[model samples]
Target: MTSASLGMAHTSSQAAILDVIRAAGTISRVELTRATGLTGATISTVVRRLINEGLVLEVGRAESTGGKPRMLLQLDPTARFAIGVHLDHAGITYVVSNLGGAIVTRWRQPGAGSDSPAEVVARIVREIGGMIARTGIDRSRVLGLGVVSPGPITAAVGMVLTPPSMESWTEYPLAEALEDGVGVPVLLDNDATASAVGEYWAGGIEPTSAFAALYMGTGIGAGVLVNGTVYRGASSNSGEIGHICVDIDGPPCWCGSRGCVEILAGPAAVVTAARAAGLDVGPAERSVAESFAAVARAALRGEPTAAAILQRSARYLAVAAHTLANIMDLDLVVLTGPSFALAGSLYLPAVEDLLSTAFFARQSHPVRVTISTNASDSAAVGAAALVLQSELAPRQSGARLQAELGPEPVPAQGRTSVVGSLG
Candidate 1:
């Protein structure tokens, strides 16, 4: 952020070094050299540049092996900052995270509801301004903003593939609109992928870990991370787990698939089942998110009907999770998103049980399942990490984070194109 005093790393080698130090928590120069398989001279040179740039700090010292104590180094948590916002029909979440992926500020706001794209954009701009002012962090320290939502983001057609409750946003030039209003670079991503990166960036998962972030908001999706990089499949649509068919003869899905996890076990399905079971989930006028939350709360409160419906959905979800794990051979699967925040207690065990018992790799290495520490705000936190990742850790996936939002949606008449590729 302080380019004159703390120039940003410009090479993959430098990014790799920063990532290693951050992931290690603290490592000596010798360890970095060994870990990276780089020459001592190269490690020294890169670490020196990082130290000079204020990205790395020489911490105390490590035990010596019949020699002088080795100096240890670490990422400076306060060195830089980034913003993340998760846009969903349930609620909008905002978070500010430092270089170490520690969230410094967070808040929530009403979902888009029936608001127009322009109005929502204005509110997002206003909310970010207030949030930054409240945190009191220097603007110069912030790398930029990252925004996540459901996909496939057919920006070319000006709409989310599965439209969030904010149907009016179907034709919005979201990235360009936000950047213009916020006066900062804005990157876009799907919530599931953002959650995956958020977990990796937070250093909870190992740097080379292979994991999937199973996110459930208004809809369900998953994001996979291989090593530390997002395993974006061809066309950046690697984690559309919601479309995985769990039952061949079940209900139809908008994705043109019969018995997809989305149609059979997503929040809408859960809520619909609840109502059909003669349970009072919520008011008819309430949002689908609200209805689903009612069911979750009731299930937690020992309502037999609600629990039955929710557990059924959880089982369907687990079926999908099992399928995904088998295909990816993942080491971990994290349940995250606003919906999970409300009923993860019910879903966690279902997913865990299935993976532990049915995962193909169970005989070799047991798969792990856990809820995201920032579950309710996982997407937003990940979005914030997007800025940090783009600038510091970059990516081995070829495209920089800022340019990885699939395609730039065609902007409305009189407006610039949505931010992607061209940006």
Candidate 2:
């Protein structure tokens, strides 16, 4: 065989073995051989390589089944680290995570509201350094930095097609700028997609065949996990549930659709409805996010007016949730994001009730519904997980992100519905 082919085969085998070890939590060499369908000799060679790479470690021995006890192999969670940052209109969040996708430390800062791209990038560089320094994590140990936000990320060009939310921060080279400042590779992805990956990697969430991380903030989107990996559809942006029409004659959306979920039921829509009704959510000067949160807080406080407002929004969201559950045949639905974090209590039962009784395949398997524990920081945490996923389990259904190139200046006049994705 050719030398290149031999090297490729060797690496593939090592990746396969490591994946099995990670999935099994702690496994013996004999079990790995069985799981991988590789010979004992091949497993031993690959495992030795993984151990040498500091990716796997020997944790005590398993119970003796027959001869001598076998050494249990497990992933070395601390062998690597990744930084995640979420850039948004309301807040910028940062988190440092270990190899196993568990957060080690986290920090929060003000969002990049009306700030120039250069100014925000400078702050991000400084904070990432602070996180690394305070956590005492060696710089070499950091695999990369993952950034998630609302812009249209075209991984190939490394240029973001800025969205209307971050209006002033357009035509900037986000990936190249950050990478140059931090001296580490940077990955830029949308918040909804990142949230789904975070849900998969988070220790708090249970594994399922199909699930959706429904992220609700200024807008609404879903990150779908099918068969343990993200399902990045045709254009690499599959889960924009917000654009789906929930009402034909409700209202027109920026996407040129009438009665889309975002316009009819998103946080902005909810806040607008509340204000129109003279509910004291907040003054007009307050940000939409703040007013929406105030409404949620009041709902939680058992105010009838507030409860009715949030409940109406939840019902609209539940329509989208039910439609998603039926189409995906999902076994789990995780509500997350800034809006869901504050108002999940109102949204939960509405979604749960519909899925329980109305799901198409309820007889086969009942779907479960819950809120994301990291809802507030899901994008940031998932951004870190993207780094770990690329290094550890590179095998996925969708295409990998293309190598980034020099950034191009693009106008935000027309933003495409689809963006880059991690699949």
Best by lDDT: 1
Off by over 4 Å in 1: 1-11, 154-160, 402-423
lDDT of 1 by residue, 175-233 (tens): 77787788777677778888888888887787556789999987889989876767777
Against the reference, the lDDT scores of all candidates come to 0.79, 0.76
Error of 2 at 75 (Å): 1.6
Tens digit of per-residue lDDT, candidate 2, span 1-423: 222332233226765676567667899998887776777898898788878878899999999889999999999988888899988888899999987778999898988888888899999999888889999998877887888786356553333454466866654667777877887777767788888888876644443368899999788888897755677765456687888898899888866779998888888888898888888876777777899999998889998888998888888888888999999899889999989988998999999998898999999999889999998888899889877665565443521343221231121112221111110
Which candidate's TM-score is highest?
1
Query: Residue 294 lDDT in model 1?
Result: 94
Cα distance off (Å), candidate 2, residue 214: 0.8
RMSD of 2: 6.0
